[model samples]
Target: MKAIRIHEFGGPEVMQLEEVPKPLPAADEILLKVYATSVNPADYIIRQGGNDLLRPLLKLPMGLGLDASGIVEAIGADVKDFKPGNKVYGVPNFPGDGGYAEYLAAKATQFAPMPHNITFNEAGALPSCALIAWNAIVDLGHVQPGQRVLIHGAAGGVGNLAVQFAKAKGAYVIGTASAHNFDFLKELGADEVIDYNTQHFEELLHDIDLVFNASPVRDQSVRMKSAEVLKDGGIFVCSQLDSPFPAALLQVLAAKNAIGTMVGGGSISYTSSLHGTTALIEEGKVKAVVSKVYPLAEVAAAHRESEKKHVRGKLVLEVAKEN
Candidate 1:
């Protein structure tokens, strides 16, 4: 099988397309004939060894992908939920990193049946981003109808879905994006849109029930400003910040008596642990927004596009063309 793998971490140039052996399913896993996979920022971060603390866990000659949609070609002995020919989509286990290939062996619990209404490419775009959004807004934030929720980076993959998920729950959703993306975010069900380039969101919105910071602004200063916008007892869910309070930020969070939680946004354990995202997709309450698609060989280009930080939605790698 031909898959993209990087023997060493560095730049996009390191992602080499090479021949590799197909993976076999373990007792609780399923072997999938991958139809499509999507690129997440975590893919590039892992490629560069950004999270060095996790280096010991990530094997070398690593495959680089998190989300995919495909058909089950074979199921492991203990996998009773699915069978061969079942259409499925989910995130594969991270550190294992095998989605950039024609086939992957994913734990059965991480995936869910693909919705009949969507295509494989669209389903492929949902897992990582949608799961992050769901875990933040619905699961942890416990957003309720009539409450106000603010999502930073509203036009990006996770933000787009967060907007939709908040709206579906009947929360009045506010999102921050560049001026050009205002209409797009509004279309995604954001009740209010802040142009981050021109306006300070903290100055304009306050007493929020939930604040989701999906941007890369992890500095203590920025977090301090964000903390000001939350109502007393409100929750702030951040993808970039650790939840345990890094001593410095702990002071600020304690000053406001606000709740803080870190949502580890991307997980490969979706095939088993995060299949709930698939149920949301199948139920039509949520949908994946794919802003771009590239062929398998152009994985580097896909990474380049993702680096732009202006992507309105998810980007997918078309590993296998539809018949």
Candidate 2:
């Protein structure tokens, strides 16, 4: 088996595609012959050594991905929900086996049946970011019908999905994005779109019941300013994922009467939140928003594109086909 692993973290250069023994499923896991995977902010962050504290604790030589879509080649003795040839998608939290590989052995609970009508590429583009959106919008925000939901960075991976999820719940969705993506967000069910490059969203909208801050420093880290538009008792969930709150963010939230907290969706609980999107995918109300696809061997190029942060929707890794 050939998989990408890192001996040291710094840049995409750290990821090495080398021969390695294929993993075998544990008694509670499933073995997947990976068809596709995806690049995420975490992928780049981990490769670039941004997680300084976690880096020292890592096993040194470790795999470098989190989300994948594949076919079950074998199921563990205790696994009953799937069998050989079943298609699945999952995000197994890293520091474990990774997705940028030919095969993966992961806990059965981390995976779900891929929606029948979509391609492996689409499912591959989900898992990590989609689960984040699901957790922030559905779990943390507790969005309900007739609620007004505002999503920052609404054209990006998680924000795009957040818009759809909010719409599915009958909330009036408003999104902040560049002028180029205004129409795109509208197509995703955003009732109104604000061009963050030119307009201030908080000035234009108020009484928002929920605000999912998906922007990573765009609008200069608006978590605090975002509270200005939220209704009293509303929820504001910021995704500072795998990092501490942008300095003084907690203080700003503390001053508000609304429920405000950052969403750390990369944990094991992300797998459970994925189950919610699985339902929406099956209902055909939600799907991947992939903007590009690259071969598995070109993962470095994918990382570069993700780092640019202008990628619409998501970027996918075409694996089995590349092999």
Candidate 3:
């Protein structure tokens, strides 16, 4: 099997496609014949020495991918929910071997049956970003119907999905991106789109029910201003779970009697998250926004594009073709 592995931490150039031995399923694992995977910020972050939580668990020569959609070639003896040949999509193990390979043997619990409405490339794009959005808006933010929700970085992968998910929950979604994405965000069901470059969201919007900062750039000033727009007791959520919540932001939340939280390795089961997203996708309430698809051999180029932090949606890696 060929896999993208980084032997040392560096740039996208460090990711090399190398022939590696195929893995067999463990007692509770599934051997997935990967059809596709997608790049996320974590892929680049891990390639560049990882962060506090992941650095210790990572070893050299690790496969690089978080999300995958594929067919089950084999299943371990302990696995019961899926059988050979089931189409599935989910997040593979993190800080360990991942899905940027011809096959991946991961715990069965990490996967769920793929949504029938999407292609392999689109399915591969959903897991990590969808889970992050689902966790932020549904679990942490507790976004309610008719509520006003604001999403930062609304044009990015996670932010795009966050906008859709909030809309699916019946929230009046407001998104912040560059002016060019205003129409795109409205098409995704945003009631308002603020051009962050030229507009001051704090001055323009107020009494927001939930503020989800999905931007990868960790700007404390944005968080402080975001807190200002929240209604009394509103929820403020950040996607950078690894970073500490700023004290001043907390103080602002405290003054408003609002809640401040971050979306981390969520406690919800992967099965539940994927299943919910699958339902929404099947129901036509949500869709994957893929910016580009690269062959497995062009993964380095894909990483380079993703690192620019301007991709409108996911950058998918085609690992194999569906039969």
Candidate 4:
């Protein structure tokens, strides 16, 4: 099987596609004939050695990627919910095995049957980002109908989905993005959109019930301002992928009587998260938006694009033809 593997941590160039032995399903696992996968910040972060803390725990010759959508080619003896021909999508054994490959074997519980309404291209990108959005907004944020919800980076993968997720719960959703994406965000259910380049969001918005700071961590000021827009008891959700939530930010939340939340590895909860996202998709309340599709060989270029951090939606990689 052909797979993307990195023996060294550096730039996107460090990832090399090579022929590797295919993995077989264990008693509780299943083999997937991979059709598509998507690029996440974690992929590039690990590639660029930004996650040095994890390096000591990681083995060499690791594959890269966390989301996949494909047909089940084989199932282990213990697998019951899935069969050999089922179409499935999810983050399988995330942070351990990568999904960028012609074939992958992962625990059967790690996957859910693919949403019946989408193609392989959209399905592949929905796992990691979409599931995380569901967890953050629905599970953690407890976003309720009629609440005022503000989502930073509302046009990006998690933000875009978060906007819709908030809306689905009947929240009044506001999104921050460039003026160019106002219409795009509105299409995705943002009730109000702010141009981060021109407008100061905190200056104009207030009394938020929930805020999802899906923006880059480089903008440290944004986190503080996101906290500023919240009502006394509003919740501020930050991504743990980049910066840790500083103690000062926690103090700010405390002063406001609000909560600062950063979700971490809940590998045990992934199956439920996948099911939540799938239910939303099946209900016609959520849709996966992909900005670009790259051939498997052009993964390096995908990393470059993702690094730009302005991608309107998720970037997908077609690992195999959808036959």
Instruction: Work out the TM-score per prediction.
Output: 0.93, 0.93, 0.98, 0.96
- Candidate 1's C-alpha runs over 4 A off are 241-244, 265-276, 279-283
Tens digits of lDDT, candidate 4, 240-271 = 64467778788888999998887546633677
Best by TM-score: 3
> In model 3, which regions exceed 4 Å deviation?
none
Name the TM-score of candidate 1.
0.93
Instruction: Count clashes in each candidate, considering only residues at least 3 apart in sequence or on different chains.
Output: 8, 0, 0, 0
lDDT-sorted candidate list, best first: 3, 4, 2, 1
Q: What digit string (tens of lDDT, one per residue) describes model 2 on residues 87-196?
A: 88888646546789999899888888887878899999888787788888888888899999999889988899999999999999999888999888888889999988
User: Model 1 over residues 51-112: C-alpha lDDT tens digits?
Assistant: 74456667787887988899999999999999999998887877566589999998888788
**Better TM-score candidate (2, 3):** 3
Deviation in angstroms for 54 in model 1?
Answer: 2.9
Better of 1 and 4 by lDDT: 4
Off by over 4 Å in 2: 218-221, 242-255, 265-272
